[model samples]
Target: MGGYGSGRLHDGRVLCMGGPWVSAIAKDDRFVAGWVTHATRWGIVRGRGNSGGMGGLRMSYRRLYVPGATYFFTVVTYDRRPLFSDPVNVQLLREAFRRVKQHHPFTVEAIVVLPDHIHTLWTLPEGDADFSTRWRLIKTYVSRRCAKTYQPPGSASRQQKSERTVWQRRFWEHLIRNQRDFDNHVAYIHNNPVKHGLATTPEAWPHSSIHRSP
Candidate 1:
C-alpha cells in the first residue's frame, strides 16, 4: 500500500521510498517502534507503528507496492561460485525462468547470466505487483534441481529452513523509474559479461538475452 515519497523525520534522518522499498532512521526518544514483520515467501515487509511516533515514522519501513511496475534485479550465487559456468546449469536456470513465467506471467525485458550471478529486468502485469513470489519460485526451482550437482554446503540457518546452498538469501532490486532508466539498466545487463571478462562483447555472450534484442 505504501508508495514513493521523501520526508524528514523528527530526528533529522531522511525517510525515502524510491520504488518498492522504504527505509528510514528515527530517534528512539521521538519514536516508539513496533515489531517488524517479514513475509518471507513474498519478501514483503510490514512495520507496525506505535501511536506516539511522528506521522513520517509510521510507515517508513514498509515497502511500496505499485502494480504494473518494472524492476531490475541482481541475483548472486552463494560464495560467488561460478555455478553457471556449466552449460547444464545455465539450461536449468532457463527452465526455472520459463516455468515460473508460465504461472506468474511477468515479462522479462532483458537478462544476462554470468558465471556467478544474473542481472535481469522484468515488467509485471497490470493489477499485480508480486515479483517477490515469482523470484522465490524461480530460485527454488533451480536450487532444488541443481543443489546436489553443485554440492555447496548451506549454513545452519539455511539448513534449518530447508534451503539450498546454491544462491544468496537475498537479491538486489530496484524499480525502474522511467524509459531512460529502463534503457540504461538493459545496457548494464548486456555489458555485465564483458565487464566481468567473460566475453569480448555483449553479443558474444552465449547466455545473454541481447541475442533476442533488435
Candidate 2:
C-alpha cells in the first residue's frame, strides 16, 4: 500500500508522515507537533491522507445533535458590521429564511434580527436534527442576495477554510432542555435588542416575533 506523505494542515502547515520528518518552519510547530506527539503518545493511528479539519477551526465545546430538538441560536455578522442596520438588508434576511423554510421546513418559534447579529429559536421537524444545513443554506442565500459592502480581512486560517467574513465562523447553540429552558431562551431573544441598547422594549423592536407573539 502507498504511504501518506507531507500534506497541508488546517493552518497551512505541511504535515510530513513518513519517518519522523519535521518541518524547519516555526509556524507549523504549534499544531503539527502537538498533534503528532498526542498520536504517538496515545498510539492513535490516523487514517492515511486525513488532515483533520471540520470546516473552520473548532469553536464549540460539544455540539448536541439531537434531530427534531428545539434549539436557541445566536449568530453574528462579520466584524459586527451592523449589516442589518438597513431595512432592506433585514428584509433580504427574512426572505432568505422564508425560502429555506419552504424547502427544508423548520418551525421558527421565536426570532429577533439585530443590527449585527440575530437570535432565534427553531424546532426541527421530527426525525430531522440538521440545523447546520439550514444555517449554511440560509447564510449562503443571504450572502448572494443581501446588500454586502466592504468586508474585513480574514486570517490565514479562515482564508484557508474558504470562509467569508460575512458572518462569524461559528454560532452559539443551546438545546432547549424543557419548558423552562425554552421560555428563558425566548425571553433572551426578545430582550437582546434592549440589552444591546438598540431598543427600549421588546415591543419596540420591529424585527422581532414579539409583535406576532402573545
Candidate 3:
C-alpha cells in the first residue's frame, strides 16, 4: 500500500523501512540535549542523545519484543567517579526503572550496582515499544538534579552547587542478540568483582543480583 526507504545503521545491520511504512520496525532516531562524546564498552560513541535514540542497530540485532528479551543496560557516574553519598540516587535509579516498566514495560531480569556504575538486564514486555526514552528520562532527571555537582568547565553555573549529578549523563546498551551474549553480559555484571580483584566468586559480590536469593 505504501513505499519504503532503507539504509544501514552504523552497527552494520540492514535497515529496511525507515518510517511509518513498516508494520513492525520502530522509528529512526531521537535527540538528546547537550550531548557529548563518551566511551562505552563498545568504544567511543556520541552521547548527544543521552538516551531516546532510534537506530537500526538498536531496533535490529533481533527485533526483540518486550518481555521476550534479556537486555543489558548501564548507567555510569560522571567521569566514572563513585559518589552516591545519597541513597536517594539509588532510589532515583530504581524509580527510573519503574517508570521504564510503566512505558516500555520490561521486567528487570538482573541488576548490579558498582561504586560508579550499574548493569541491568531487562526482559521486554510483550507488545511494547522501545526502551530508549526510559533511559533518557532517567539520565535527564539525574542530570538535572545533579547539575550543580559537576558543571561543564567554563559554564556560567560552574560557581553553583546544583544537582550534584551522580551520573555520566550517558550509558551503553545492547539488545542481547542471543542467550550467549545475555549470559556473557550477566556474568560480566555479576563477576565484575573478581575481574576487579575485589571478590572471588560472583555470588560473593554483594552489589549484584547474584547475591540475591531467587
Q: What TM-score quantifies how close candidate 1 is to the native fold?
A: 0.69
| lDDT tens readout by residue for model 1, 34-61 | 2112232355432222221111132222
The digit string of per-residue lDDT tens for model 2 on 1-214 reads: 0122333332233333233334324243466446555654565422222111112244434454554566678788877888899898888888888888888987777789998888887776656667888999888777766423635654657656666667876677765544444567768888988988989998999999877623
How much is the lDDT of residue 114 in candidate 3? 67
> Stretches of candidate 1 above 4 Å error?
1-63, 154-157
For candidate 3, which ten residues in a row score worst on lDDT? 30-39
Error of 1 at 161 (Å): 3.1
Residue 27 error for model 2, in Å?
Answer: 49
lDDT of 3 by residue, 105-208 (tens): 55555677666777776654433335666667767666666556654556445336443444664565665543344456657778776776767887776666
> Candidate 3 — what's its lDDT?
0.51
Which scores higher on TM-score, 1 or 2?
A: 1
TM-scores of the candidates are 0.69, 0.67, 0.56
TM-score, ranked from best to worst: 1, 2, 3
lDDT (CA) per prediction: 0.66, 0.65, 0.51
